[model samples]
Target: MKGILKKVYVIFFISYFVFFTSWFPGLSFFNNSNKVELNDNVKLQAQAPDYWPTTGWRASSPESQGVSPQKLQEMEDYIVSENIGGYIDSLLIVRNGYLVYESYPSHIYDANIRHHIFSCTKVFTSTLIGVALEEGYISGLDDYVLDYFPNRTFDNMDYRKEAITIKDLLTMTSGIAWTDQVDYYQMAFSYNWVQYVLDQPMVHQPGEVWNYNTGGSHLLSAILDRETPNGTLDYAKTRIFDPLNITEYSWNLDRQGIPIGGTLLHLTPRDMAKFGFLYLNNGTWNGTQLIPASWVAEATTSFIDVEFDQSHGSGYGYQWWIYNWLNAYTARGSNQQYIVVIPDLNLVVVSTGNTEYQFIRLLVDFILPSAGFTPLNLVFVISLIVGTISLSILLGFTFFHFKKKRTIKKLRKEFFEETDSNGETFQ
Candidate 1:
């Protein structure tokens, strides 16, 4: 009996140790005692203007403020009530250049944290294509896919495949009958993802119809890699990231070592806001032309009208999503992450969430309406205060719950050992 008890105790201890090591390698690192302090100087410095202003003023606000307080409150209420899958993490509203409103859900407020942008990477990738075209790296958007890959050959290669142009891929009319469900991650990890995508079976004529193809965007990265002086990443650094002051970010690569243009770019919420702001300002930032104004107009302009409205009430524009709201355009990712840019309204709203289809509705019904429409400043202030307090209480409960669990676990182990010892003595 004593031997059996010893074996059980040893097994339990080993299992717990292994589980703790695997699941919480540095649990103490996250404790309040070791928490890193944020620099006070880096907090948002933008001040609200004395008077509620209209659009295009650029005096009190960053560029020019638009929307009313009532509308902004409506939006916030909608997001909170929707309870979209993931926490909203962070939301920022930039009208003109000034930061109008910003919020960070209790669990996700760090400025340096980079959340996965998913399909929004396509918008950035498309922007790079515009840069490549402007710099004369390639001839034009109409350049054939075959021109970029001379050595790589395709099976059933016909005029349709040969005739397929870079523009076709950009517009998602590549004529390739490929579904995104196939172990595309594995295929992308292959030594030649571009060749694999090109070799896909042709279902229709090039540019005949639209098919949302992530692989198509990867081909853009491949083409960029072939034509640019350096690689696509280097080109992006020089043309996009560097100019925008986006230093800390990451783009995942395919098996062939090319940045996956379709998805998997990680960026801080603020940096993501910068991208939207660049588009909002017509590709100009801080008095410098980062992206060509012409490209900004062209990219956001509806290139293809998707037949069905996405759950988010958005249409597709050259990798950008067109909001149902008065011609607003956005860069959207899975789980409701959005970089919404309303050029007509001079508004940019960035939100990250894990919710399902309702996120779009939340944005349309709630967030956008609140931007500039609320009646009284006191109401907004009271609501914000209440919301903050509620969130803090919720976080406190979560922290205490975990701490109790840890203590209970320790107690259970001790109790079990004592029970085993008593049982052994009786035997």
Candidate 2:
């Protein structure tokens, strides 16, 4: 009876283990300290905004915007506990065109302060190119590179260099023979920045390879300067900034007085989100189309499949990183600056962190799930409930079986003792 009960107990535990593991495939409840508890069947109903955030954004509670406040709190706590609090400049989440969550973790930055958004400036540069195309300042994406700089003669002149197009530059597949780490520093110190970029020898045919070249981005800025009235900075001030009411911002210029297109644009976190919101609403701000709808769609679409070995992206669009899993896109920069837009969720997340942390992990593991995007699996829930009930029944059966056996053994021992005593008395 003891051996049978022992075997039954082992079988019960094995079944329980199998059921538990099957219920949560990827997540181990005992292993991960920060395991996500499912908020089952959460349907996000976006609340329409009362007004456009052209002048300033309206504030709303996370729950009101169909965002989980508990998840946001967990994200904040993770930042603090990870010792990333000091380096984090700002973190803001915009859902349904309202500012749902905002945190200045570093305590040094705020809504009023402008933060330097490094390579995120590239996305803005790409946007201006779209604007210029719409306004007829430039001809089209297929226009050759050499045609733009007709006055200047370039070195290593080949058919490949002549074949480079604006679209090639926009997608970072210019095929220019340049190492970003070495060449970018050299280009920065050179006398004529645009001339230096244009003069680089063609390594591969344009649009055949994807290489990160900040110099190529600067070439874009120079092109804008030539095509647009007054220059890139002035053109942006009139066309983008003033219209969006984005006042109090700065742009750093190159040696040739063209705005450094790859980096060095500063704006407040709120203002950074406005650019994201503009893209989210398909380039429309308020009732007016700030950027052409077609341009926004084309810019965010992945043109090249590149690998950065990061959670944020493995695909590249026109100056945008595509997160295919989330069906989102981001204007990502070094040191963890990002303007992530999830169209499906009607969400925009902006962060300017001086220190590098896995912001994508936060987005995927916490934020997206918190937005109630991942619904609980019905099969798993049903199995969990059934397994718990079965285990309870098995435990109760085992307990009663042992109790009944003990009772029978005690009665038999008492009967034998009485029989022995009566037999001895008769003798």
Q: Against the true structure, whose lDDT is highest?
A: 2
Predicted candidate 1 versus true structure: per-residue lDDT over 1-427, tens digit per residue = 4454455445545444443433331432222221222232111112222322122212233223554666656666655666542467777777655577777754655667888888888999999998888889878888888888897678778778888998888878889878876736656666777777887878889887888888998989888887898899999999988877788899988766789989999998778888887776667666677777777777776666664334434456677766532446778787667898765445677877654444556555555554432212233344445545555555566677778889999998888889888885433
Reference-based lDDT, each prediction: 0.68, 0.82
lDDT of 2 by residue, 194-236 (tens): 8888889988989989999888888788899999989999988
User: Where in model 1 is the C-alpha error above 4 Å?
Assistant: 1-66, 307-315, 372-427
Residue 162 in model 1: lDDT: 87
Position 118, candidate 2: lDDT: 91
Instruction: Count the clashes in each prediction.
Output: 24, 0
Clashing pairs in 2: none
- Top candidate, metric TM-score: 2
